[model samples]
Target: MKRLRLAAPLAAAVVALLPGTAQADVTYPDPQPITGQEIIHDPTVIRLKNGGYVSYSTGGVIGARTSKDRVHWDDAGNAFAEPPEWWYEYNDTGDPWAPDISYRDGRYWLYYAVSSWGTNHSAIGVATSRTGLPGTWTDQGKVFTSETTDTWNAIDPAVIRADGRLWMAFGSYWTGIRMVELNPRTGKAAEDATVHHLATRPDAPYAVEGPEIVKHGRYYYLFASYDACCSGVNSTYKIKVGRSTDIEGPYVDSTGKPLLEGGGDLVLEGHGRYIGTGGQSVFEDRGKDWLAYHYYDAEDDGTPKLGLNRLHWTKTGWPEVF
Candidate 1:
């Protein structure tokens, strides 16, 4: 299925709103250029032990791209050259969506989503590696599936540790963001679950998805991508954020509005030069926070490519693009 597309005029309007906005301290690659293939989307950049970066993203096959300077990337080929047999057994046709890589408990875990476009029958699967690189990954099998077709559509898996417990926050389309505790040692959901409705907009052309969480100071912030994300040059994808003192929360925006009520502080939008700047994930490097996402390069013949910018937190504790 073709991905959802956004209206051109509306996308342009959102881009005009950005500029001179709050920014965080960050250093961009001297000359920014498209680093990987055009199909790369929902990228997760993880700093390796050897002081380099490895990225994973959505595609039919799990693939890897490496960067020495975090600017230029070299495709390391498919991490899983073939789709896991189990995924094929469950669903005859398989297309892997976003994959988030994390290292914990002496293992490198890759949590990924599998589904066909525009469908809610999605599942989040897991793979592991000892070296956290391509060719070394081993599929550990599916971790969670969307049990309730009426409520939440599970995809875009992000795992975080809070208050001595491991938790995962994931959802898309059907409702909003939902979280469940995980047994960190097993990388599986815990029995005691606490789910939160992070964001929803029933009146908009699109709904909330792509929940990427980070803890700063005394608050846990949830950053999500909203609107249509795959319309090529017509995409309206933008980044939004809400925060709370607790992990599973009634996260609120700067205006003191709960995320479930369509409240979010805008972080990145199409700025006329770049269209649909969302599907973001935060990477903290060298004591600074960097926003990694994909956007259509307006100047580069309008192709979707990976982009990175630094995130600045305002004195009042609000985050914006740098």
Candidate 2:
């Protein structure tokens, strides 16, 4: 039960007094306390066409949860009743991480990864479903992969349609984040596509992963997690972002420092009982933009759980969650 502890009455009163469009320097509030089926990591959410919200996460067979009101979630099932037959060939664990869910052309596309830790030997795969419900997906096979010789780890798959073409951004703790073009028709890596290097931390530890990209207004914003993760309450994970006028970025932070040189604007960080707030996904739902991610609950001895917060755009075009 390591949920966020906000004074409900005080929070309500604060909201009641707030004016439209909070100040650009406003601090992000803690996530609303949610109950039931909370264990999740690397979560990505989608608003169903019928209005119910569903989230997919990293877990055995890809974790799935649903919510009717976006505040109370219930475990639905795993996206796969059984791991896809090819998963074992990449990693014997039969688990997938950091699923990116998107809908296009009347179908739902889910991209995920299978790999062991501390290695570049990994693969990104895709599945499509007419209905995004659990067990309905048809495995679309490998979109891309990397070997030990490569400088990048091919995991943490995130897809977006930019400039009328499907593109994917992925990588972790090696050469930083990288991007590639996808076959618009198949949602797989496009033939003859070139990989484009995106952001990286040139400093020690160089820990960056869980990239989610969104195009807002005239800029493409790259959101990524920084620092160490998976260490329970000791994890130092936090979310950071940068923006570029073009999808293929020379992304820069609020100070105008380039992300290629380790610059990023802080978005959210742990405070009080919430720790390691990272692994995020952004989407527009019910007329409001939302950020969905997982945070380690310090009160629960560092168990990870799903967290959601409304996102707002600043006057200068930066995105903030409060």
Candidate 3:
């Protein structure tokens, strides 16, 4: 999720950055060149109302940065400065991961995950702000959570507004992605609602997480990361996608394979010095689409860095990153 698809800073030859494809292909492409403030994981960016850009990512305190041109960046500081009092209830280490940011109803809503790695003990929480700047957010407490007894883990929260309602899609390593209805007035799960199961691998390792949904034309596309991550150069993380008519989807790939059965079309993979590229968000700015994610820099000994690229819709209606 991001700001309204309206005005944004213009770059030279935006069309050249997004090459058109008449047909979808099996192979993925490389990201565009970017420098400055590279270290980021599970990054989400949103354009400020004043035309600047702000980004948040996983860290001990939720790392943040600001960019006037969307290329050169400066550290803006963390949302909490110190961990919130309630964070200790979910994560003793006080670390957060995979934050989702969006503008809505006169405030910026940030949803993030709290849990130890490789465990179902987790919680999804939210913070709200009027300016979206650092140290301004007010913690709204846990939106959702899970325990060892649950079939799904509550992490990697990706919220989107669709069908006259706010929906949050999240889960990791237990079953796959799950969605629940959120009250538009409070940004919390609605009372007496059914949780919708979205996607899963279902095989050994069952590697699927980081679900993001975007609507284009007649279809709503679901994008997710597959395989292991945080293994340095050995990481096998890649991005895949599927589409559906409804937000709560029986999503299918180009070959009509159901996402519920481990079906997805390849969107991006590691190339050259970039390795383990996954955890993505999509947004449109100034009539052009962009894909944002993180990649481990093989040349820099697996340090995660920000990666951005122009996204184009093929004549076949599938998205390709250029």
Candidate 4:
């Protein structure tokens, strides 16, 4: 079984500790023993048709990294040779951040965010690629946007298809997480698509974002990053989750408290040398689920390293990160 491949690492660690199940966590995902170009932020990873893994992230024209076995990573260069001219309208640097990659139809579609720091004036853009490799993508333009006057900020997109319809989940500190339906034909928001709120921190600056949805059994689960990020060791970032039966959700944690009310069961948090575990996305490989995020390595002077863990579920249906 694909899950069995991770058992060796769990045995080597000599103990089992799961997020939200334990008060003190000393072990986590690092046993993949990831190597090469480990510094990354806001990563969205995907397994290619040819069976290699590629991840697109924030920085340098949508920075990229690829691994043949999901362990030994190599810097694969930026997704675009140059930023599309449209990007400069959102930021002077034409920098894009937090890309989500998915394979649809016979091609790959990439969605990313362009925005300035400390502002809600942001836009999420789309690009398409034939090979799902860096540099093969052609810019396709904006999928969604948020204005300063609006309550939700558009960034950090994660897409999921449910019941034959495509949907995008996105948002940042302004009002937390929100969702919109996408036109599967063009990868854009559906005509007159209504924006829906998913989760929020319930306070000013809400502090929740980076949402990814995965369907399992009878429900759709929402996984998200909470708290401050990008501060290295000082970062208070953590990963949390809630689940709902409907694709458009009023998600709730195990306690039955709604996510819109600042409730989520803990999934991963800073433990031992792994600090600030956030900027997350999840992907399925070999019939198993893997949670992917970036963490600040205390031993490495707080350099961000990729966080990969085999995802498990409790008998009650809650997520447990190993």
Candidate 5:
């Protein structure tokens, strides 16, 4: 989910650059049929070492669920049995949201946000788990933070590893997406790391957040949620993308417009029952890439549900979802 109401509807703005499957006509495909424990928001899913799958999302203590074949799921439990003491510093309830899970250095790293609604006083924290399962995480502590004085909000954290360096991309309506380097050993912000701006709307209260970076071919693709979220059926949340040859970018849409100037290629948008398709992450399994996100189900009266789609790449390296 995102903070602050959006200033305007996202540009109808740009069309996806798909060629074959999602080619022509702007057809937004429905999510793959999934059942059981499907309601979730801002989901971060990992294929466990046991060959099963576990997903953690925003809710009570970072709500969790599991699956055996990636179709049927079961409620597992919360990732944390209790909130860490420091979490209260950011928010009264110590509620955490928009978690990112990844495997690095032979262990799993979990990053999540703690903050109250509509405020930039936020913190992104880290926890580790050997098995990456619910109730098995060890709270490592806070990694980064932001306050009312900070231009960027430190929420919706997504991390990507490159060249032995850990980089976290985070932000919200305050100033769009931002990236900072993390200490490899500690998984915390580097002592003097500079926060680099990645994407934003040209105006104030820019509605871009939930940054996910994936290295494909020679470029790094930045995926982010644009417009409003958490409003049920009325939500205008959509997914957009930009790319850069360098990790610390200068990312731009297909037309070569810089993301810093509000440029991004429309990737996924609301269509049919799948409305507000955003809060996404990308993970590769069995040599193929997959996109995981949440959508407001129109048929279900705008209930948020898990959405999974196999990602296809164009010959030029941009991503496509059908």
Candidate 6:
């Protein structure tokens, strides 16, 4: 098994000491500013068993944050618990991006990717926590690598456990979205497995990426961010979706069109001053699904920041955000 070494016990102990200093109450997905400084991108929030929320994101030395209210946040700071020793071996300049959290088997598991924009040399790393908070994390290191320097870019990983099987959806740029099965116990890709391409657009210069899968009403819905992102005020990103009866999909949009044929129902796009909104993670709180994403804060001179909106499912089973 390939592994990446994270920092030692010092960092983890420091983070563990944090939750003792403050306490807040968890609430619904309210529209509140969680991070007051730096650009927060690729936000993934999970509800811990202890009744708090933990959020992880991209591009900073800090890997996770803790919040009692899901609005007010405190930086747990660098839960990688180790230096870049392992990640540096893979790509020295790449930053850890878009961490997805899942609680299973009496632990909190974080699956994340490391890569720079437009590069295929990306790898997915994992860390586990006995307690879902910051300090208890045990970095299990690299579980899989794209290693596909020529054909496809592998980044933006999201894992979903459905029908007693663990499935991973990931890809970007070169060949679009792809899925493969993983060994549930180890959270590693199955050996000799083939990746199935779920979405692609060879004709469009802009690509489909950031694959996020969620099961709703006997259908597996794959939500992907389309086109370019991270251009600040000039971004061109949009949210699109396709659904299929099977977890491994031939996902189709509402018109009975396959996603491979460029069929997607547009969910959210830039409005007025807000430019290029996409890269979404949907979460259900109190029976209502909320869309969590980052967009340029148009009012603040177009500063890129995280935003939240309540997701409404239409009568036809499509999703929309108000």
Candidate 2 Cα RMSD (Å): 5.4
Which residue pairs show collisions in model 2?
Answer: none
Between 5 and 6, whose lDDT is larger?
Answer: 5
Error of 3 at 286 (Å): 1.7
State TM-scores per candidate. 0.85, 0.91, 0.90, 0.92, 0.92, 0.84
Instruction: Output candidate 4 Cα RMSD.
Output: 3.9
Distance (Å) between predicted and true CA of 27, model 6?
27
Model 2 worst lDDT run, 10 consecutive residues: 1-10
Per-residue error for 198 in candidate 5, Å, reads: 0.7
lDDT per residue (tens digit) for residues 263-299 in model 3: 8987777767889988888766777878899999899
Candidate 1: C-alpha RMSD to true structure equals 6.5
The reply for model 4, stretches above 4 Å from the true place, is 1-31
Whole-model Cα lDDT of every candidate shown, in order: 0.74, 0.84, 0.82, 0.87, 0.87, 0.71
Q: Can you give the lDDT of residue 217 in candidate 1?
A: 86
Best candidate, lDDT: 5
- Where does candidate 3 stray beyond 4 Å? 1-28
lDDT of 1 by residue, 270-306 (tens): 7556788777788888888877888887777667677
Candidates 3 and 6 compared by TM-score, better number: 3
Total clashing pairs for each candidate: 3, 0, 0, 0, 0, 3
C-alpha root-mean-square deviation, each candidate: 6.5, 5.4, 5.6, 3.9, 5.9, 12.9
Clashes by residue pair, model 3: none
Model 2 lDDT per residue over 98-210, tens place = 89999999999999999987878899999999888788999989999988998888899999999899899998988688999999899988656798988899875568898
How many backbone overlaps does candidate 1 show? 3
